[model samples]
Target: MEIDSYFIGQLASEEKMKEINPVLSNVKVNDSNQLQFFIEVNNGLDIPADYEKYFKNQVIRCFESNLNSSEWDDLSNKGRYFRDDQFLKFAKNKLFIFKVDVNDSLIGTRLNVTKNSLIVKEKPKNISSNNEKTLTTIPIFRDFNVNKFEKNILDSKSIGSYEYLQEIRSPYIVCGEYLYGEFKNFEKLNDGWHVEYEDQIKKIPIDFNKYKDDILITEHALYLDENFLYDTLIEQGLEKLGTIITKENKIYVKEIDNTTNDFIEEIISEHEFLSTYKSNLKAKNLVYDSKQIINFHTSIKTRKLVILSGPSGTGKTQLVFNYAESLGINNSKSQFNLIPVKPSWTEDSDLIGYLDTINNIYRPSETGLIDTLIEANNNTDNIYVICFDEMNLAKVEHYFSQFLSVLELQGNERKLSLYNKEFIGRVFNADRYPPEIPIRDNVFFVGTINQDESSNSIPDKVLDRCNLIELVTPENYIELWSKSISNSLYKNELKQENKVETVTRSMLNEWGDWHGENVLNNKEIEIIKQLSNLFNSTFTIGFRTLNHINSYLANLPKNQELDREEAFDLQIAQKITPKIRGNSEELEKVFDEENGIFKILSKYQFKISNQILRRKKKELDIYGYTY
Candidate 1:
């Protein structure tokens, strides 16, 4: 019977209940302790004449002592109510709104961002009425390379010269977060930026350092530091906030968010990699199977190294490249790198760049792999892809040995050795080229391998380290080919109406924890052990291999059209069988149709694995080999 929440509405009498359409007059806790509204409705859309007056009266009552602890929590957590904590004064006559559902329950639209900023440091109400009219706000807009704006317009010293400065009516201009400066009679103010008012401002004691770059003509830079803005919690969504933004559309970060209208990442898509794959199918005419695409994504998440191995002209390389294009990074070289691994690449130097011992300057590789990794480490929020096309052209085990070892480790422990210990202190430009680069989780490596005569065999060490997926030809290949060929890749088409969600560095880091403390369930563990024992006679399955299989299962998107048995069947074919490809003679006993892997697989009702074993046995008999 306890009422812990209130909805603004006209309190109806028992006699007048039929007149109100879904008029919620009371709230009560049901037997389950869930809040339930008591509504009285007629079959009409028409609202009563005194509805607003009654609603406003109830709102006033709710705002007073009637609001319980749960309602206050809802106000802050669910973004349902405007906060009076900061210096946000609404216009006296501005009408407050109650966004409600059909049952008249309050609907919280703004989430995680509606709260007032605690760190913005309240600006002075003392700026006077005259100055408020002449005040304006601006973001760190210099990142845009506008012609005159870059070279001359923002030149603080030459501010009085440009007619654009004269057009500015605001005397006091706010720039980046809470920092503001007076725009008095030309001559821009960079150092004298202040966080007005005493409460939040005095504690932080922030100043502007004119976030400058080499592109400007003069030594003076007219920009504010982004870090400073972030440090003040302005970068975080404290929407309806004036500290970072309240001027333009009343949101945070005017430049990036407003331009593209990119909302929260989760709002776009939960399964970003799979979502982007489907988007590329229609938008770019890609013909890779959805299951294959899903497997590829799960592989990437489970193991940072994904090897796309198959016959030539099977879109092995195209799949990797298309992923970058689908991420809206087709033109961004920093985030997308396609390195054509050469036959001559015996060592890692050709890809990671060797330290010039003579000059002490670290010369990074031209392939952009090292640079992309470095950028990934710095910008952990972004996702970086490095595709080694025809990776098996050279011996993969030799060139990729460093990454193979490093990928086994996690977080900061995964550093790639670049220089000798003696030269570490002496290495010049160490800032740009550290002694060893941290192979962060943000960068995922994909290698395309064609199992042709020209390519060398991928060793057990390499196989154990990566998720090896052989590309399967699409069932409707001819139809998909015709569709793709007819659709021009270059010509303009309708822009993607839906904002495609991109998988980021944070998502990559979070994959390990997606499952419980133990990645594999007891049943899964027992089956993998049985399978490993079956293959133990030939080649021992290491923890790394077991971990890969378990991770793939753990990271697979829910409702993925794959049952555990079906997926495990694929994993065995992918993770286990590929290791002993050419050496079918060694595994001849275990590969028996009636009594070996098939018997164990059939016992578990893994029909797919049983079928695949039959196919592999056929391949062994006819082609004298299997992978």
Candidate 2:
């Protein structure tokens, strides 16, 4: 049922006449009036002359016109005109013929006529005489039994005695050396049983003798039925074990000795600390779950840098402490370390390490915390984060500028080693690991900032590298606080726990281009004035706070559609004006109706501390009633 053969052949022409007439160019006329022009076809040449009419006249019109021309006048006189010949002359000076046949019958012929000419096919051989022979002659297995027909080996015409007689109808006979056959009538000697034939079948059994070492047994192999393997394993109830698959598809069953907490710790350690922070908050009911974004470490997979910031008394420190405890570090691991940062500690040596006075040992302080972070990680691949609380209390640019550069060197060869042991000029001589270690992909830096009276602004350079997420004060904070406190302590609990959870990075992003945007509104106008006063008193905050407020509100859902004008006004009103109210004379002199609200807001500078307000409270109270 396969393709026995496939090819092409000439299709017969129905036209009458030897020479093709100008009017009937497709017609061929021979001298005897037998008309036959070559027609191209595929498969066997079964196409008859009657099928020629099926070809449209338009198809042969070009050839027809050529025949009547002077150049083709001789061709017009030929017995038949063949498009195949013309096509052949137009192509290569040769043609291709694919002759195909099935069991000696001319099933088909494919003729690819080209420029010159070609032989279509070889004439088939006559094999009928060979078919008459009833003997096997293949040589590889040597299975032929030649002595089956000894009686047929007559006295007159016989080949060698060793050769069997193979019937042949041809007049010629093959030489004994060239002839092929089996010994006929050999089966008669063995009681009509062919011993050689039976031996050939025995030789065909499966061969496994070549493989010895890898074979487990020499016995019969167990053949598996359709579902035998599945059924056998299911009966043993192996599927009941509480096992989970690893990435490679290896199943690990839960073990009481290992405990769930152990696996949880592994999973936690593998994740960057900042990413875990967001998730931890949600789990602790501190923040909404939607804000939990997974942020992993870049090159240092073992470290995390989280910067937490909010207004004063927002409970950032407490939350961070809780976070540390939840990691089981506060009790179980001495590895957990907290270091307080001061605004005055201004140098890279302050954070990295510095030589101490007593014996000139490069003693570790906050810098020791950094050293501990590097030392504590059991696996270099795990992250170890240093949480810098109130990071902006000191100008980050002032204190950490050099440290930042060293960190940026990341995977480079920057080394820090101890100096002399006796003088106050050396790191510990304990050969305590080399310094300036490559900052791992897992180590992290988390800083907390209080966006209140005593902080400097975080620089844009710092923000660009961090994934800052704002912790927005949950809407349910009051309810949660109430539940956590007695009725007498409700007010204090609410005040202490209340906070706005928002990330500084996202806040800055929302401002777009605040410096180029428009003027401030009442709310923004007010906030700006307050911040200005606070800055003037202690040199604590600067224009940066104003910008930060603008940035923060810009991202809030409530602040959507805030054009440039609205954004500027909102920053001034909500963040700037309130701080200025602490000064009574300044407030009254500038904001009094006689001076005009917009004018005072635009030009006044009552920048001073909140303590000034208490001293002027009486004057402010009197002035307020007059207004």
Q: How good is model 2 by TM-score?
A: 0.32
Per-residue lDDT of candidate 2, residues 1-627 (tens digit): 111112122222334212323343323444554432342232122112333233222121112321112223233345245644543333222111222211212663222222111122211121111111121111111111122121122211222222111122111111211111222322212111121211111011112232222111111121111132223322222233212221233335666665645533212221123323433443344533222122112111212244665566656665655455434344323234556788887865666666555653555554466465456443553324456778887888876775555554444432233333344224443344333344543444666777667878666556533434333454555654443343233343233222312222222223243333533357556645654453454233455444454444433322112223333433343233333443454455434445334333332122121223333445567665211
How many collisions per candidate?
A: 1, 85
> lDDT of each prediction vs. the true structure?
0.53, 0.35
Candidate 1 residue runs with Cα over 4 Å from true position? 1-267, 271-273, 483-494, 497-503, 507-516, 582-585, 603-612, 622-627
Highest TM-score: give the candidate number. Answer: 1
